[model samples]
Target: MSLTISELQALFFGLFGGLALFLYGMRKMTEALKATAGSRLKNLLAALTRNRFTGLAAGTVITALIQSSSITSVLVVGFITAGLLSFSQAIGVIIGANVGTTVTAQIIAFNIAEYALLLIALGFLLEVAGRREWLRHYGMVLMGLGFIFFGMELMSEATRPLRDYPPFIDLLRQTRHPLIGILAGALFTTLVQSSSATTGIVIVLSGQGFISLDAGIALIFGANVGTCVTAMLSAIGRPREALKAAVAHVLFNLGGVLLWVWFIPNFAQFISSLSPAHPRVDGCSAAGRRNASADRQRAYFFNIGNALLFIGFTPQLARLVDWLVPARAELDQPVQPKYLDPYFLSDPTVALDQVRLELLHLGQRTLAMVEEGLNAVTRGGRQRLNELRKQDEAIDTLHGEIVTYLGRLSLQNLVEPQPRQIYEYLAVGSYLENIGDVVETNWVTDGFKRLESGVNISTSTLRLLERLHEQVCRSGKITLEALEHNDLEQAREVLRSKATYNELAEQARTHLARRLVVVAPSRLDAFRIEMDLIDHFKRIHTLFRRIARLIEVSVSDSRKTSKSG
Candidate 1:
């Protein structure tokens, strides 16, 4: 039988449009769910992925609620960024997403087409009639459900002629060729971009009895590989850790495809022998073609089987990904803020302006480290020190940023006035950062070791110190604001509070010092802990002084401006 171009055109448009509708609906549903879920989706991964079991359960429920595995995976990346879950913990979540995604297949398989219009009307009502997030959620769910069902029905109707078209059947026959079939499936899913949609089409075609089990399984395999593309796209501008997550997704799916390709015949027999029914292909008559419908059901099973096969290896697979793209090593040095140049200033004047900005940025970084150190001694079971190192890195990054900006500025031929202003800013930035170092130097790295090696602060003393820490943080904030805005009034208040907090903080030390000398037993560790908290408050006071100085300089500058004016 000769094939007409119009028949091919009809088939192409139908498939393309069906796939488009499926993908578009998936995107809308994903964004709406994420928006509605807000930070709760983010917090879920953080609290949930502590262990593989929890991770899996969380992933399943979250993915099911979100209705898109891609959204679930991206949320995992956010959790990782927030330091909520480690890369390893993310593995089970990804694996669970596979199972969660099957909800789409199950939903699509239901005969909701008859109710699509009614469902859409209800969805519109919910959308127009509600201030509640749950109602909005229900509205989005209804809309997605309506769209998916309607699109599937349109696809089925449009492709009805393919059942009788010898040429169309001949093309579908290529699905029996594992490479050709897998490639076709992968390409279609990649282009249409939803494994669920691809799998849904397989169900519809199988139910129609137009494609055999062997063809369906090959496409299912292809759909698995195709799913990774979205993750890969997300990794474009992200850090290496993010890239690894996407890579893990790819490697996990690709490995499954490779394993199944070798055992294709065995897998095919398993899927086909089950003869799971495809209700779509049974459109002609539910009583006829039970075997073909079974083959289609097996097609879906093929996807699940492969995902199950890989889920076991998710942890082991994470290790492989780690080997391929190792976690970036922890930086050993205190990074200067100068290293973090915005690098935006290409012109001499602009570069100088950037240098000044970096100087401020650098000061801010040091201020953060000082802030964290204040908490480390005062807060119980201070988080892993390395975790607090981000505060230090923030300082170092700014130092590097400023230095780089300065170097670029120095290379340029600056005018008389700007050069002095740039130099003064650089000098001020360096001085402020030195204060940051003084604060850093006060951090008892060994002290924490000596303390946690089991030194206990008395309950009364601990409570007093906690209150002191609170007061010190206030002083720090006040000082920082004063300096940042050059507010002399805030600066004086910061200094006054610093003196008051220091006197109180110092009194605790004096009591410790006297106890050590008289009635105290030589629990030198306890003494050190008391002194550490005392010193923490001391550094807080010092940060305030520096900020006060910044305010003083700014005030003097204003006076000079007044004189010039």
Candidate 2:
């Protein structure tokens, strides 16, 4: 008999609503885990990608911690864009992420739908009643797990009627064909944007006796391929490294599936032998539980096997992906912010790390301007001065981008010391920008004035200014190194150089003072220009010290915090 309208509504609402809960729960769980482990995760990913094997382990552990391979993929892409993780290292992580994602399917296979409500209630109580931040986070984790299981229960209940529905049974029978099952699985996963969801649904169908183990295996294979869409979408408008990483994900998943497609029956039989039998009940049966177990086992086997197959070929794979996604010519044209990836803003710790890297980029550019500005003022022609001025414009553009990115970062829900870190970065960015301003506004104008008035500085004064300029540039470079490596000693070294710079400034002033009396044509103008240059260089020196001091304070605070923890 044909189903009535009410029955159809029940099925539609239950399935869709369950999916909504599942997605929301997954999101909630992922967010809570990320907030709890964001800093450690960043450190782990950065430190552990020494080789393919370690990278694979790191990827699997991180994905398991957060329970979302999509998020892991996003993190990998962001790290690649920031130059924290190389593309080849990211490929290994991508392989491990596939294995990590199978944990969700394994969790779904347990016979715990009956306790989903209890978990929800306890999670709610803990979330509302707990006083500590971490307690609340754990509570959310529990709630998220509850929602996932509850969603599966809802889906399972909704499809119960399908056991007797002739049309539905016929459709499920078609899935026995490997290609048809794979297609359906891939399409559904693409629409949902979650392989776990597709896996969950497949388990539900198997439990209800709607699909056999062979079809379930095919659908699981397809889900692996479809899940790559998340990584690909994230890589859009990102750097070529990110695109290469995404492409690697696609190749690995698709290749693994292709490797095993023809062995579905054998795979199914092997998985069946490994999985233990489950007793039949009113809503679920031995076959259903067995199929669910087998599907999850198959995922583990598929991803781990693929990781082993490709782990040794990472260098080759990276080369192939690089060849596939060639670099654009415009990569070197503009001075855009290299490390300020918007994807990282979701996790403030990683976002702050990106900001630090961008600051290093900004620091290098500003230091170059300082060195060139000195040359333009003392020994270079009008053309060189104009070029320095243009370079300052680029500095201003980069400074603005850093400030805007930090402003956006400040809006995030920052943890302890992160708020202070943001302020420090803002201060450092402004200082670096001010150094560029010193070059363009003060030093560059002084150069123009010197050129226009035909003021000729004696060789002695030029040599003195050059020495001071060298010292200033050296200090700036050291400060940048401190910032880049978080080296406390380097920061302290910059601060300690203040006395030496002071002596040099005093000597330059003394030399200029002695020149004022015996000067020839435009002699007074020459004295003023040299004095102005000395003063501008002193100003730049002071800014670098200020930046160094900020680094010193930041490093000290971090050490203290670490000790306290």
lDDT, candidates in the order shown: 0.65, 0.85
Stretches of candidate 1 exceeding 4 Å from the true structure: 1-13, 262-315, 327-565
**lDDT of each residue in 454-539, candidate 1, tens digit only:** 65556767676666767766766666566545577887787677567767877787777766754545467677767775775676
Best by TM-score: 2
In model 1, where is the ten-residue run with the lowest total lDDT? 338-347
| Highest lDDT model number | 2
lDDT of 2 at 386: 90
> How far off is residue 272 in model 2, in Å?
1.0
Q: On residues 9-46, what C-alpha lDDT tens digit does candidate 2 reach at each position?
A: 99999999998888888888888887777578878888
* Candidate 2 wrongly placed segments (more than 4 Å): 78-84, 278-286, 330-332, 411-414
Error of 2 at 404 (Å): 2.3
